[model samples]
Target chain A: MKVGILGPRGTYSEIAARTEFGEEIEPVTYPLITDVAEAVEDGEVSVGVVPVESLREGSVGETLDALAWLDVKVKSEIVVEVDHKLLGTKDSKLNDIKQVLSHPQALAQCRKFLRKNLPDAELISVTSTAKAAKQVSKLRKKYMAAIGSSGLADLYDLKVLQENVQSGQENETRFLCLSKEDSEPTGDDKTSVVFYTEEDRPGILYEILQEFATRNINLTKIESRPSKKALGDYLFFIDFEGHHEEEPIKEALEEINEKVATLKNVGSYPKRF
Target chain B: MKVGILGPRGTYSEIAARTEFGEEIEPVTYPLITDVAEAVEDGEVSVGVVPVESLREGSVGETLDALAWLDVKVKSEIVVEVDHKLLGTKDSKLNDIKQVLSHPQALAQCRKFLRKNLPDAELISVTSTAKAAKQVSKLRKKYMAAIGSSGLADLYDLKVLQENVQSGQENETRFLCLSKEDSEPTGDDKTSVVFYTEEDRPGILYEILQEFATRNINLTKIESRPSKKALGDYLFFIDFEGHHEEEPIKEALEEINEKVATLKNVGSYPKRF
Candidate 1:
């Protein structure tokens, strides 16, 4: 099966795809997360892998919104521990580097290291960390470096000047596997769904939550994003610990659909640690 | 009284500050949102103004986390209509410009305009739009331009190349007035708070929502941010209608504080349209 990922190659998304589908799969690469999702929906690829959440950035809005608007199901999930390293040309020294380039989030994650060690270095935000490594390889500047993964070093033929440079050592990103096909129920599974409140009334959300609580199903995550219709209006994205095929979960969803303006099942898949 | 804002001036934050404190108020400029919050907490300014939310970007995580970490209260909220314009040096021609420099958010907002007009222009992300204007003015490069507000044109003595360049015509940002002092109860007011669930129970959040629902208070917004403790652990930031000083609201908050692991009242302020 052909899998799609955000890449020029060596991006975290590509790493996640390889982790899930094996390193020899040779997944097709897309420039943007939205493009990967589009490829899956259009059948250009059987599955698409994209980052959905991170410890520092919270949820990825584009991925969430794409799932909501398109007819796709989250077939599975994969979690990767992110380690951003400072990469440069073979001859470049860390202390002599004058500038660092990477995606904004990567730059933010390694903020402390850059500020302390390369206090005089300028930070230039690029499209992605992989692109940063690619640029550094092309420029071959004596005083420039990039923050990315060791995988990036191999792909772009760069050297890892420093390892694990991020301020938070515990940073991890959750990636979702999107496909047109749904997954069969596993004993331990998760159902992801989005719902909008039935009306602008008090206690409406309580009514929705009561559906899960009474069934004894635990909620894994819940977030509300603006509906964009107005300031106070919101659409809720929720994840709970259950398969849709389960009797209690089925009953809970039936009750929830009745109380909500709209409900879309993103997918049900085996939960990942 | 002095107000703090994210600046070298001509930023949207400055516009919000002027809207709230009048054009005559002398505002102090900080390079980062965290610095503005710090200025307020340190009593360097009477109050600090910072962007908290926007139609495009749901919430400013830095501001939200800063408010949670600092001992400050949100005094009020100011909504500003964002209108991005393309500005250039006096001798710079629109067709000759090879680069457009601005904040990342501003560049994203003007994606359509940049793609259609200056398709070949290299997009450079700067710290702030005002700083972009400052750079263009100082460099006096005919092939360089900046995306900013019309106010930036006046401040930097640059020419307006184009106006209203954002993709969405109705783009607006919500700025919060932060201070050490809390606000008084107004007839039409809103309360903001953050709380952690007592434990990973099936319906603990439902019970918390019931507290406000039973009191007939409506929730304006609800978002879950990673608590940084673990993967599923979240700190819920919620905004609801009615002032905390109101009898029903006060009683509801008291009840909630008892059931949750922890509860913090951000503040009560008049709701803006």
Candidate 2:
């Protein structure tokens, strides 16, 4: 399989791509999540893997907004455990590091370790941890290190100066595989959709929720984003535990359509535990 | 009035501090939103002005999270129009610019202009636009420029090479003046609160919204953030047009408290239009 992913090659998105597809999958790299989705839509790749949510970061808005704007569907989901490592050239020692570089999120995750160990090191933010690792490899700077995955160490022939240096030990990120084709019903699935209410009334949201409540459908996620036209205007992104083609789900969607200004189904895929 | 703000003297936050308080007020600067909130909580400042939301970027999660964690309350709100300018050293020219520096958000807002004008110029991200201007002034690089408010030009003794470079003409940021004392109820007031549902059931959210629907309160904003413990766990932040002490609003709160697992009243203050 050919998978489009946010990458320089050894980032978490690459890890997610490898997890969802086999390790032998061909990887096409994109600079941003929107571009990754675009590659999938334009048939440059069979599928795209992008992080949808993080335990501490809430929602990855860029990915969500891209999904809402593009005519793509979710093919599968995978949750990857985040373990940020301190990578350095094989000849370098931890005490020799005078600078650190990584993506902002990865840098943030390992803030405590960085502050305590390399208090005087110049911290730089790059586009991705993989890119940082690549730069470190090219420079072979004994006084520089990059925070990335252990897989990056193997990919770039670097060494893990420290393992799992992130402050939050329980961090995990959820990734969604995007494609033009929707997943078939697997009996256990989740439906994702983005919708706008017809009016900005107090009970308008309540009325829409009633449709699902009456049918005993369980919602897994609900988030609101500004429509970008005004301050208070919003669009909701919801994920529920049922395929859209299911009878009760279809009826509820019809009822919801009557009360909403617009609705777009993001597609149903088998739930990943 | 004394206001704490995020600053290096010429930031938009400093402008907000001057706008909400008189120009004569003393402005204290902090490095982070949490520190500003801490200054207010620790009685170091009477009030603090922090950007809470922007038309493009949803909520400033740091400020929202700080408000939730601290004992501070909202005193007033102000909205500032974001007009980014291309700033340069005294002897610099636009044609000579080979690099640009600004906060990532400001850089993003002016992507179209930069692509057209300085396509080959290296874009560098700094902690704040004010800091960018500071760096440009110190370096005096004929080929370097910064994107920031026009006020920064005077503060850093730089020149405004170009005006209104942001892509969105309607860009504005909503700032909340946080204080230890809550504002007394004005006839037109907005109440803010954060609450968690007892369970993630289909109808549980509808039940909470019904409390406000029956009370005839108009909701201005509603956003959900993950509780950070797990994927589906969430907390809702709601802003509505009513004071907590008001009769119907009081009853709605009582009803909401009965149905939710936990509720936190952020505060009520006069709405800024």
Candidate 3:
């Protein structure tokens, strides 16, 4: 099957795709989620891997809204540890390199590296980590380099001049596998959905949530993004620890849906550790 | 007054600081919000300036917790428009350059630029825009540059090779001015507070809101972040368009407080635009 991970060239998405589909699988690259989603919709690709945190950045809403517009199904999920690496061409040696190029996240994650090692150097953020690595390789500029991932450095034939560059040691990113087809249940599974509260009145959400509570089903995560219809009104993205076909969770959600104004099941798939 | 903004030198924070305090103000540069908060708490700086979106990134909770722990007060606010710029050392010559660095937000905001111009180059991330500019200067290498604010580029002796790198035309950031000494209210004001529900029951929050609604006070924002103590329990961060000192706001809050398990006034400050 043709699979895709976000890439202009080297990104965590590339790392994730390889981890999930095996290194030998040919991976289609896209610069944006829309393009990836479109590839899946157009039958150009069977699946598109996307980052869960991309939603946290507000762009996820655009992607989701685009998906609703595109009518594509979210079929699976994959999670990867986000490890930032500093890559430089043969010329941008550590001895003289002054500017570090990377995606903003790579830069943020590796703040400690910048502070301690290149305290006086400039940090230039690029579009993606892989893009940074590709640039370093192509330019071969001295006193300049990119901070990306080990995979990118390998892809671009650059060197891992530095690694573990982010501020938090426990950095992992979750990605969703998108397909036109739904997944068969994996016993240990997760169901992700987007739901809207029934009304502006208080306790309405509690009523909807009580459905899950009464069934003793566990909810793993919940996040709210503004609906734009009203300032405080929101669209909730919820994930719970169970398959949609399962006993209690399936029953609880049936009840929960009745109470909510809207509930769209994004997908159900094996939960990645 | 000594003001603090994001810096070693050059950044939107530096521009924000200068705009609010002018060139005469002594500005202490901080790499992170917690550090700026620390500077304010220790009396090393009179006021701390921070980007609001950075708060959304999870630092606000820590900074607020720091203030709650340190008892530093929010005195005033100064909102600034964060304009991303494509900057390079004058000699780096745009199209020839292969690496670009920037803060993550700058990079994200300017995705379209990277996709169109440096589609093949690696995009690196950095902790801050100023740091990116500084690194480029220090690297003194060829084909490397950064995207930052105009002010930051100047601070590092870089040139604005391209302007308006942000994807959004109206993209602007709001910065908060915080201090330990509380200021008397300026007429236009807003109140921010943290509150917890008495129970995980429905209508409990609606009951609290009835008081505000009755008083005709509009709530600007109400966000829930995990209390981190329990699975379902959450702490609510609320902002409303009124001064706590106002009679209606005082009476309404007094009534609402009687119903909650806990409540804390984060602050009431002039709603500076």
Q: Can you give the DockQ of every candidate in the order shown?
A: 0.42, 0.38, 0.11
**Over the full model, what C-alpha lDDT does candidate 1 score relative to the true structure?**
0.85
**Which residue runs of candidate 3 sit more than 4 Å off their true CA positions?**
A54-70, A91-95, A230-232, B1-45, B53-273
Candidate 1, which segments miss by more than 4 Å at Cα?
Answer: A1-9, A25-33, A92-94, A97-99, A114-127, A131-143, A230-232, B1-4, B7-9, B24-32, B44-46, B86-148, B153-162, B168-170, B230-232
Models, CA RMSD each: 3.7, 3.6, 7.2
Candidate ranking under lDDT, highest first, comes to 1, 2, 3
Order of the predicted models by DockQ, top scorer first: 1, 2, 3
Give the better candidate number (1 or 3) by lDDT: 1
Query: How do the predictions measure up, each by TM-score?
Result: 0.85, 0.85, 0.65
Give the whole-model CA lDDT for all candidates, comma-separated: 0.85, 0.83, 0.68
Q: Candidate 3: lDDT over CA atoms?
A: 0.68
Docking class of 2: acceptable
Better of 1 and 2 by lDDT: 1
Candidate 3 residue lDDT tens string, A214-256 = 6766665554544544434556666677788888877877887
What is the lDDT for B261 in model 2?
73
